[model samples]
Target: MSDESNQTEGPIAGISDVPVTLTVSVGRARPTVGELLSLTADDIFTLDKSLDDPVDLYVGDHLVGRGVLEELDEPGSGRLGIRITEIAPIKDLV
Candidate 1:
């Protein structure tokens, strides 16, 4: 009954394979540095959120969940996925 009592009864048992970086905040645009140096390559800048907005899932700035932006046709893996919906309360993700 020891290994330090099973690692103190698992308070995230030894970092739980530590690795954290989940940030998918899909909207934010404050273009001005002369509209970000007058970009020209199919230029389009307008985002404060629109397109059925609900995408914000961070692990650093801590907003921890909310999603709905998905497009993964799966033929050639045209990636982009997130469909969580809402989940920010484990004491607001610490």
Candidate 2:
């Protein structure tokens, strides 16, 4: 690595105190409160969305990004591909 590469010509921006959230969906077939309480390790619930559909992601209730799933860490672990995504600064909402 070069020392000069670490230096920048402009003032640093966005030293933010912003908070964000991340959530993943396995197709949103979530159960109702009564049904949820009855669920156990052996139980099965089906998803409302199709497997090939684009997954929706949100920060709070706002849409933030979109992606298809790709495995990470191991076979059961995956990351979103995050296509066409943007996070509008929180101050804009205020």
Candidate 3:
């Protein structure tokens, strides 16, 4: 086998079949029924993460990367600003 035969593809593109754990934001807890009802006019529920805080990225039970959430102007169209911290090894042979 020649070296050229070992290197042919530029990149491998496909779907990832890995288990991941994502931490979702619950925002502020509702105080009371009256207070919750009163909160209507201009209510802003802030996420748990701060602007400077690095969001934790996990693959199954392992921590692999961190990303920031950026809001999009066109409604719910935000993207995950990912910074890959580690390259996780694919276990189970399939």
List TM-scores for all candidates, in order.
0.29, 0.52, 0.32
lDDT per residue, candidate 1, 1-94, as tens digits? 3456445233455664568999888799988898778798999988999988998999899898898988788656778789898888665554
Predicted model with the maximum lDDT: 1
Give the candidate order by descending lDDT. 1, 2, 3
lDDT of model 1 at position 20: 97
Model 2 TM-score? 0.52
**lDDT measured at residue 75 in model 2 versus the true structure, 0 to 100:** 71
Q: List candidate 3 segments past 4 Å from native.
A: 1-49, 73-94
lDDT of each: 0.79, 0.60, 0.50
lDDT (tens digit, per residue) of candidate 2 on 1-94: 2366554343332323345776655477768999998878989888887776667667677665566655555675554454434455545433
Q: Residue by residue across 9-76, what tens digits does model 3's lDDT show? A: 42321333334465533233546688777787788655665676666655454655455555645667
> Which pairs, if any, clash in model 1?
none
RMSDs, each prediction?
12.6, 5.8, 8.7
Query: Which residue pairs collide, candidate 2?
Result: none
Shift of residue 35 alpha carbon in model 1, Å:
3.0
